[model samples]
Target: MSDLDASTPRIFLARHGETEWTKNGRYTGTTDLELTHHGIKQVKGTAIQLVGPGKLIDPGRIAHIWVSPRKRALQTFSLLFNNSSSSIGDGTTIAKTKVTITEDIAEWDYGDYEGLLVGEIRAGRKKRGLDSETAWNIWRDGCEGGESAEQVTERLDRLISEIREIQEPYMNGGNAVDVVLVAHGLILRAFAKRWLNYPIDSPLPLMFSPGAIGILSYKNHDIDEPGFYLGMALPLQD
Candidate 1:
């Protein structure tokens, strides 16, 4: 937190920890799955290292939070603040932060391909002559009976507008209005893309590992110049 500009509000993108479907590389969109024991440990570790007063994500500084409606994301958000109580490393309470469970930040709807592996999806598509021309690409072709890349872009853009509206007033120095979004892998990446005004089908190679955290903020403390942080060092805390 110290390494970055305080005047620029940050959006902490937290990808939910691993589930059985995530571990098996299955398409988990729209599926309600609980975190595995190991996944619980992953988020707990993230909480200790990145959350708390003077840490990368100070609960006290967060003004708003958007969580995916999925259970895994809900579990991750709870674990992030230690069950949403004053039980984090420094016992800083985030109860004041506005938390919204939103479908906008949820994973891409896999629709007919839900619960299927990548190879399985490809094979299915090939068998049906769906990808006979250019192969199956979620970014390009989207999921069958689910959402298209354009549809995803629309929702994500709307969410980004809401976030920017909240962050605009605070960008020039005021009460900390940082935001937090707890959700899944693919959606978070797409959110990042939209945050930077990139199209959802851009070639940017963005990957969000489970339980990982990424930061988005404005450049030069200007809300109009949104950008993502490549890396940030945690502040030293007593």
Candidate 2:
């Protein structure tokens, strides 16, 4: 059993809201795009859910809020936590506490096919008997100039290590420490894979709709022998 399995902490992962490429099903890696109007509403909606009853995360108690350096992610983080009027007045406000930007949390590098649509890529690959399924799953086989699932796993592992350092100071405290991460789709899924202890190369059976949120926490009663608990909220389509 790895150390992550032993001291798993509660974390909230929020995928950045929709972008032009996202709505059109293009490979949106590394490219910085703004949130559509609907995307903005989704972020605010998720924020409201977090701030309401039965879900209130005490601002004063949150351990850390990490965000991807991408413009979209940074903007989402700002909109979510920068509202002083909506703040609970307990923990550090968004403006006061700079949400740490982590490169490890950025989207997967899509390489040669960065802006291409799935169908377009598939049609071209089909000329050589390759199809969409075979290509999109390229992470398993490795894509040209793109990071493989194994490489992404390495980055996710590093992020988990950083989380451990944060836990060292709070081990004795009975209170729960919460972390919120504003990141990209693939990176957020990578984090999920880490939390679940899944093989990164294993089929990405998981899908994160834009603006969706997930909770990573322990399920078992025993802290010494903790179990991973994953809760996913589907992104609103309409």
Candidate 3:
């Protein structure tokens, strides 16, 4: 981890809400699934707790928003910022932060394994004379015909570096150098680990629930000691 000033920069990692694959533990990459009705309601609660004035995440403080190009993630972003249903809240009250759709944040490209659960993929590999027991950790053994851990790390490193650049000018300018990222589970986890300079294959035991929110920031606002802060309001109250 790097050391940072009192307010170096903040990157908020938000996993999209539940989709059919989300609830099924499938490896969802290019296959997009709309949020479940329950998932919509889930994120609405997150918005109320985190987006409004005097809340954990002041909408005005956000400098840039990056979301995956996937429809699921876009849906998640919309529900959080511009919810149209009465159950979610009014979009008019939310700040209209410009959102960028980026492929860097998309889920791991599972390739031939897309939409297959871990067990199913492993079983298939074993039946094909391949080691599936422990040789199939996505971080180490990337999906066939898809991205490798090295590829994912390289992409995330580039994205993280650019994000740093985006926030550089805003440092100490009284402008919040806060960037929000809405993406899928695997890639988002990899991004968070990469932010801390952790090896992509490090068995870090990190887990992300559907619609989970994770925050990364420099230690004391300095760009050096990057660390994860358990500050995001995934949910506040009813």
Worst 10 residues of 2 by lDDT: 229-238
Q: How close is candidate 1 to the true structure, as a TM-score?
A: 0.94
Sort every candidate by TM-score, greatest first: 1, 3, 2
lDDT per model vs. reference: 0.87, 0.68, 0.77
Evaluation by TM-score, superior candidate among 2 and 3: 3
Give the runs in model 1 whose Cα sits over 4 Å from its true position: 84-91
Give candidate 3 misplaced runs (Cα > 4 Å).
Answer: 1-8, 84-97, 132-134, 169-173, 231-238
Clashing pairs in 1: none
Estimate, for each residue in 114-186, the C-alpha lDDT of model 2 and write its tens digit.
8987677666667767664555565565455777778888988888767656654555455546677889887
Instruction: Give the distance in Å from residue 88's predicted Cα in candidate 3 to where it truly belongs.
Output: 11
Instruction: Quote the RMSD, in angstroms, for model 1.
Output: 1.8
Model 2 has a clash total of: 3
True-structure lDDT of candidate 3: 0.77
TM-score of each: 0.94, 0.79, 0.86
Report the lDDT of model 3 for residue 97: 45
For residues 1-238, what per-residue lDDT tens digits would candidate 3 score against the true structure?
3222234567878888888878878889999789999888777767756655444454656777888999999998887766533224333343444577889899999999998989998888888888845556888888898999999998899999888887766555467667889998889989988989999999888888887678887765566667898653332334
